[model samples]
Target: MQLENKVAVVTGASSGMGHAIVELFAREGAKVVAVARRKERLEELVASLADAPGEVAAYPGDVSSREVNEGMIDFAQKTFGGFDVLVNNAGIMDDMSPVGDATDEKYEQVMAVNVYGPLAAMRAAVNAFKASGTKGSIVNVASVGGMRSCAGAVYCASKAALISLTKNTAYMYMADGIRTNCIAPGGI
Candidate 1:
């Protein structure tokens, strides 16, 4: 019951690390708003957690849109009473294309989901926490690739941008009681 009654929003909640985080949070007594592109997967996730101590609501949407980011925060607050945590875990990888081989579309897509989306979500979270006078946490899931050149150029650049954004958010909002940090995990 460490997070009893806490509310959390997790992106990319259909699979991978995002799914795992949502389950863990629910088990720890945190209500979760699960955001993902696949509606069926989200439903399955919710169904599988029938016995968990906390609750989960599925939100089907792409993480690349600012509107979606804002909507998730709004929905969390409206549905569960508050937004206590946000996990920006939605990200896309490039196709191992080098700079010369990378297309504008690929680079833009990577950046949109990996960098811009998370930034939008974090901004909305901070604003909500500020207005409510509540302390909160934001966790942006970056990659080891961001720190070193281990992936395609576009992916590395997108993740690097996310890392920078996370750091800046921490510095800017720490005084306001919003703690932000980036997790650079190795390949799963």
Candidate 2:
């Protein structure tokens, strides 16, 4: 088990890639905190993984909220006794509207989920890692829209910001053995 004895926080964990990632982590013997807005879905996921080598706990909340982001990390440490991994996977797609057609509200909403949430979580995780003296790891889910103009303007820009944040975090914390990475997936 590559992740044996590790404790991880996985956001967007109610469905899709987040759900799959949580399964993989638990299968590898990591205690995982599955986070999402859908409480019932998170409960179902936890129940389904009942016999895995590790464990999964549900933390239902909106990742767009800074408090929620930080709270999930704290939950990982308190529940599992240690914190080692952070997977920032919660996100939402824009309405495929160009900048000229997008609303201020849409921009704020997308950016809050795609970028700000991860930022706050990363900040909280780094502090936890430093305090615990654990060399932690972080994974940010970016998109090809970040590198290309394939998606709506708001989405593309938000993803681009995440990608940059990932790079900056990796560079800033390398000396502390806190590694960070991002995956720029094209599509499901």
Candidate 3:
């Protein structure tokens, strides 16, 4: 129970790496607030964690929305007392296309989910951490595609922006006992 009595909010918890992180956090004994757009899948994930030391609750909403991020954090604070960690893992990858051929829709879609989503979540989490006066940790999931240029221009740029955001947030909140870090997975 490394995380006994701790509460964490994990975005993108409906699938992929997000799902794995949520499961691991629950196993570590942190009550998890799982956020994702797919309500059914979130419910299934919660059901699967029935025996975990920590409980899993679902908040189905678009992570790109500021309102949703704030609401999720407020809900977690009310439900579990306060938040000690945030896993900013929600993201999306648009169809691969060269810069010249990329559609505005595709770019917007990628930025909205992959960039703005995490920004909103981080903002809400940092405020909560400061208000609670707790030492908190933020783990953002990025990609080396941002570093190596394998992903399309827009997608790569979005992740690179996230990397910068992580660093800046870490620096800004260090004095308040908040730590922020990111993992940039390479290749597929």
**lDDT, candidate 3, residue 76?**
93
Q: How many backbone clashes does candidate 2 have?
A: 0
Candidate 2 residue 93 C-alpha distance from true site, Å: 0.3
Task: Please list the Cα RMSD from the true structure of every candidate, rounded to 1 decimal place.
Answer: 0.6, 0.5, 1.0
The model with the greater lDDT, 2 or 3, is: 2
For model 3 the local lDDT of residue 49 reads: 98
- Clashes per model (N, Cα, C within 3 A): 0, 0, 0
Q: What is candidate 3's CA lDDT for residue 97?
A: 78
lDDT per residue as tens, model 2, 17-67: 999999999999999999999999999999999999999999999988989
RMSD, candidate 2, Å: 0.5
Q: After superposition, how far is residue 43 of candidate 3 from its true place, in Å?
A: 0.6
Candidate 3 has a TM-score of 0.97
Q: What digit string (tens of lDDT, one per residue) describes model 1 on residues 36-80?
A: 999999999999998999999999999899999999999999999
TM-score between candidate 2 and the true structure:
0.99
Model 1, TM vs. native: 0.99
**What's the lDDT for all of these models?**
0.95, 0.96, 0.90
